[model samples]
Target: MGSGPSLLHREDIHVVIAGGGYAGIQLAKSLKNKARFTLIDPKEMLYHNVGAVRSCTEPGFAKRILMPYAPAFGQNFKQGSVTAINAAEKTVLLSSGEMVKYSHLVLATGSTGTFPGKLPDEMITVAEVTQKSEAVLKLVQEAKKIVIIGGGAVGTEVAGEIATDYKDKEVTLIHPRDKLVNGESSDAFQERLKEVLQGLGVKLVLGERVTNLDELPTDRVETATVMTDKGTEISADLVIPCTGLKVNSTAYKDSLASSVEDNGSLKVNNLFEVQGTERIYAIGDCTNIPETKMAYRAGMHAELLAKNILAQETGGTVKEYKPDPFIMVVSVGRKAGMGQKGSSLLPEFVVRMVKSRDMGTGRYWKEMGQKPPR
Candidate 1:
C-alpha cells in the first residue's frame, strides 16, 4: 500500500517535499510504506509540462496535462507556495502563513519558464488552465504565420506541433546557436530534428539572435514584425517565446547554510543531498545535477533519492547518484520526433511510441496513480 492511509498516522517520520512537481511527487509516492509526506505547491494540479507545448495546438489538452494531487496524495498534499525554509527549526514556511514541520526535507522545487511551454508564475487553478488552453488554441487557429523565438526543445516542439496540426500556418523557428538542441545533442539527432521540422514546413532561422526578442509580449498572441540582429524581418501573427527556464531556489537561500550556484541552482552532493545538510536534499531542475532538466531525469532523481533516504533511515547501504549521460526524447508532433541516449540516437519508431504519440501522458497519469482519459 502507498502512503495515503499512513499520511497523518506516521507523524514521527514525516517527509516534507517543498515542490509538488515531477521529482517531488515521485519522491513522495516512492516512499510508500517508509514515511509520511506532505507535498507543498502553489498550484492545485501537477502540470505535465513535457506535453505543454503540444497543448497549444490541441484543444482540451490542458485539462489532460493538469493533473490534481488529490487522487494519490489525499490530505497529505498542502496547496501553497513555499516562501522560506527554516532548516534549523526543520520547518517550511508557506505563503499561507503556515509552518510545516519535517523530519526530512526534499527541495524538489522545479524551475519556471514561459507560457505554453511552462505555465505562468502566478498561482493557477485547473479551471484557469483550461481557459488558458482554450485561449491559446484559439490563438493558434487564427494565426496564419507563427514565429517561435528559440530553437530549443520547447521552441522546436511548439513549431512542430503548430505546423503539423495546421499545415496552412507558416511556422518559423529562431535560435541563437547554429545547430538545434543548443549543440548538446548528438550530430545525427540534431540533423534529424532539423530534417523533421523542415519536412513539416517549419522555416529554420539558425545562428541568428533576435535583438528585439525581450521587447516582444508573451501575454497575448499578436501580429508584429520580429527583427533579428542580422537584419532579417519576419511578420508573425502569433509570436511564442521559448525563452527557457529559471530555477526556483529562493526559499533555500536565507534559512539553509548552503551555496546556491550562480545559475540559481542548489548545489547537491553525489547523494543528492544539499552540500552542508545531511537530512535536507535537492533534486530535479533546481539541483546542479549536470543532466538535462527534463521531467524523466527528475523522475530518475526521485527514484534514487527515495532509496538513499530509506537507507539513511535504516542505517543500510547508502548509494551515490551518478549523473546520467545526456539522454533526450524531443517530440516534434504526433507522428515525428528525435531522441538521443549517450552516443546513439533512438529509432524514429521508438521516439514516436515513447513520446511523439501522446507526449507520454498515459505513462505519467499511471505514475501519479491515475487513469489516463480515453
Candidate 2:
C-alpha cells in the first residue's frame, strides 16, 4: 500500500465503510467519485434519529425520517452487518458470510441506545419503526400518568412531545442531576429549557436517582413504581428511560483488540485513523474523540476523513483533524427549544428557525440527494 502506479487510479481504490449512519453515509458520498466504495449496515433504511423523538407523537412523521438507502448509494450499498474486520488480510466478514475486500476500511459503526434516541437493531426498516411509533403513541394517549427517566436531551424531548400533545396527561421527567441535559449545558440555556418544559405542563423532578429503574425493561412502555434515592415514589402507567449509549465496536474488537479503549470505543489518532493501524480509520460516536457525540460532529469527521483518504492516495500531506466547539440545539415540541453555540446561548427564535421547526429533517433529506416532502 505505497505510492505507485496502482495507487494513481481512482477506480482501483476500494474504500469499505462500516455503518450507514451520519458519518458512514457522508463519507461514502464524499468518496464516491474519488474511489470505489461500499457502505454496509444492518438496516436498509437510514433512520434520521434526530426526528425520531417527534415521531412518537406525530403521526406519519416516520416516513420523512426513515429514508431508503437504495436511492442514495444504489448498488454501492450492502444491507448487512460487518461481523468482523481482518486488518491483516485487508478484508471484512459480513454477517451473511460474505468476504468483502477493501483497499481502505473505515469503521464508522456508531453507538446504540434506547428507542427515540436511537432505534433498536431488530427495527431494520421504516415500516418497523413506523409501527413502533404508532404503538408508543397509543400508549401515550391511553396512559393517565407517564414518567420519563433521565434528564438528557432525549428524555427532555420525549417529555416535551408527550406533554405538548396530551396536555391533560400527567407527565413527569425525573433526573439525578439538578439541571437538565445532565447539567452539561450553560445556566441560561438550562433555565430557559426548564421554563419551556414547565410551560408545557411537564413536572420536573431533578437531583433524584431512580433506584429501581435499572431493574426494569426500558425498550417498551411498562407500568411500574419508580423510587428515587430521596424516598419519593412515583407511580406511572408508562415509563421510558433515555439512558447512556453503548458503542458498536464488536466488528473491530477481535482483530484490533488493543485499539479498543476502556469505555469500549475505538482509539483513533488526530488523522482519524485507528491507532496502530494504517489505512484503517474510525469516526462518529464509536471513536474515543474527546467531544460530545453529535451527528454534526460525525459529519465533520466524514468531511475530514474523506479529504485525508484522497490526499493519501495522491501522496499529499495529510491534515490533522480538530474537533469543533461544543454546539447543541434541543427541540421541545415544535415551537420551543434551547441551544448553545460556543459560549453564547442562542435565542429561542433562532433555535426554532434552525432546528425546532422540523428538527433539520429537510436538510438531511437534501443531503441524501432526495427532495424533501412538500
Candidate 3:
C-alpha cells in the first residue's frame, strides 16, 4: 500500500510487462531490484507448458507445473489483459478499464496455437489453456483411437506420451511431411524419433495432409477419420491438432514503431526492442527474433532486454542480443526421450534423464531460486 521499495519514484523507471509467461516473468525477475515493475496478465499463475505433455500422462503433476506470480513478487502483479496500447501516449489500456503508463514497455505478449482465430482476439488465457489441457487429458483417457495432427514438438510429444502410457489405445501420429519434426530437427533426431515411436507400437502417417474431417461416420468411435491430400482415410476416435502458433501482436499493429510479420510476429531490432519505436521492446515467440519459440529462449531474450533497458536509462550503450542455438529435449514417456543439443542428436534415454525423468520439476525449482532435488 505504501511507496515500498521505490527504485523509481515519480516515473523514474516504470517497466510495464504485457505478458506474465516465461519471457515477461523472467524480465520482471531480472529487473525487480532495479525498477518499479508492473506485470500484467489475465491468468493468476504461469503455465509451465514445456512439461505439459508429460502432465497429460501424469495428471497429478499439473499442480506442480504451474508457477504463481503473487508469491514470486510482493504486490507488483496485476491480473488483467491489455485490451489496447497507445505507443504515442505510452499507455496500456487494460480490460479492467484502467490505464497504466510506462516509461519503457516490454511486449512479451507471447503466442496462441490451438485457438482457431485472430491473435489476442480469440486468445485464451493461461488458466483457460490449462483447463482445456485437463479436458484434453481426459479425452485421451477415454479415447481408444487417438490421432494427433502435426509432427512438431508438441504433437510428437503428445503422441509419444499417449502411445507409451496408454498401451491399449490405438495411437497414430499424422504429419504432412515424410519425416516427423521435419525442418526444425536434424535427420538423426528424426530417424531416432521414428524408431522410438515404432518401438512403442505407434503408427506414423506421413506425406499426407488432412483435406477433410467431416466425411467420417458419426456413430462409431473408430469411424472418425481424416481424408488426406493423397486420398487416404485415417480413422480415429480423437483428433488433437498441434499445428502451430500465431503471435499476439494485434495491440501493437497500429504502433508506429512496430511492424508485424506475415505469420503475425512482431519485428524487433537486434537490441530486442521493437524497431522504429523508442523505449518499447518485444520478446519471445511474439517477436521475429530468429530463434526457436521455446520458453528458455524467451527467458534469455527477456533477461538481455531488461539489462539493455537499464543500461539505456543510465545513458550507457544498449547491449545487442545474441540468440543461442536451438536445443530440443523431447520425451517419449517417463523413461525415454531424444535431444538435439546444438548440432548433435542424442538418444532418448539421455534426453529422459536430462528432462523427462522429473517432468522439469527440477527446472522449475531452480527457476524459483530453490535447490533442485538431489
Candidate 4:
C-alpha cells in the first residue's frame, strides 16, 4: 500500500518481475533502495492458496481463498503476461506486444498444466479462481462418485476435501506410483495420508496406470469412466487428472537452451541466477533448483535472489538458496492433516489447527499485506 520500506539504491536500477506468484511479489516488496520495480502478470489476484485445493469443496472457503493482487503490489504491479525474454538485451516482451526494459529481471512465472490448479497461461484475472472454486463446489454437490487421478498432493487433498464435505459421496484417489508424493514426501508421511484417505472412505487405487484420461468414456448415463492398464474399468460421476505439469521453459529455450533441462526448467548456479546470463534470474517452478517446487521453496528462492541482487549492486555478499530441510503438509480435510518439518513428524491435531483449519489462508493475505480475515 505504501512505498517499499527499503530505500532504492539508484534511480536507474529497475527490476522487472515476470509472474505475480509468491516469489515475484515477495521480491517486489522486499527490494530496498531507489530501485524501480515492474511486476507483470495478467491475473488481478495471486492464487497461491493450496488450501483452496480442499476448501473448494465447501462453499464459504471456496470464495475466500483467492486474494486480490491489487492489494499486494500497489503502483508497481503491471497487468500483462510475458511472452518472451531477451537476456542479452535485458528486456521482456509482453503478450500485449509491449517491451519492458529492466536493469535486472526476475522470472517467477510458475508452471502450467491441464488441471484448474495449473493455470493454462498467465491468468486473465483474479476472478477466475473464484469462478473455478464455485464451479467445483457445484460439481461436488451434484456428483455421486468422484474419482481423482494421481495420488499426489492435489488429488489426495481434493479427495479429502470432497469426502469431508459430503459424507455420502463416494471418493477415490488413483496413483500410478506405490507411494504418494514419491519423490517429495517420506514413506512414513505417505503412509499417514494413506490411512487418512482410506479412513475417510476414499478408495485407494495405488500402483495402477490410467492409460489416457481422454480415452476414458462417459456415455449418456451422466457417469464418468476410465479404463486402467490393469484391465480394470473404473467408473465415477467425475474424473479429474492431477498429473502432467511441465516446466514453463519455452521462453528462453532458443538462445539459452543449454542452460535449461529437457523439461523446460532453466538451469541456475547456486546463487539462483540463471546460468550464462548477467542480469536475468529464474526462480520457482521454472528453475531446476533440485528441491520440491512448492510455495515455501519459491519464497526462499525469492529471498535469496533479492539479497543477491542487492549485494551485486551495493557491494555486499550474496547468499545461495539451499532448501531448508523438508517441511510439507497434506490436508485430508479442513479438520485433518499430516506433515513433517525436518526429521520431526507433525501431529495430526497441530497440522489440522495450523494448516488444515484455514489452510494458512489468513497468513497468505498477510503475506500480501492485506487485511487479516475477519
* TM-score versus the correct structure, for each prediction: 0.95, 0.94, 0.88, 0.92
Arranged by lDDT, best first: 2, 1, 4, 3
Candidate with best lDDT: 2
Minimum summed lDDT over a 10-residue window in model 3 is located at 115-124
For candidate 1, which ten residues in a row score worst on lDDT?
Answer: 1-10
- What TM-score quantifies how close candidate 2 is to the native fold? 0.94
In model 1, state the lDDT of residue 228.
91
TM-score of 4: 0.92
Top TM-score prediction, candidate number:
1
Write down the lDDT that model 4 would get. Answer: 0.75
The list of candidate 2 runs beyond 4 A from truth reads 1-8, 214-223
Full candidate order by TM-score, most accurate first: 1, 2, 4, 3
What is candidate 2's lDDT per residue for 1-374, written digit by digit as tens? 22322333665688999999999989987876567889999999788888888887887777888878889999899999898888888999998999999989999999988888888889998778888887877777778888999888899998988888778989999998898874567888888889999999999999999999776645455677879999999978788888777998777888889999987799998988889997899999999998888998999899888878877788877899888777888989887888897878988899888787887899899889998665
Clashing pairs in 4: 7-32, 7-33, 8-33, 8-34, 8-35, 9-33, 9-34
**Which candidate would rank higher by lDDT, 3 or 4?**
4
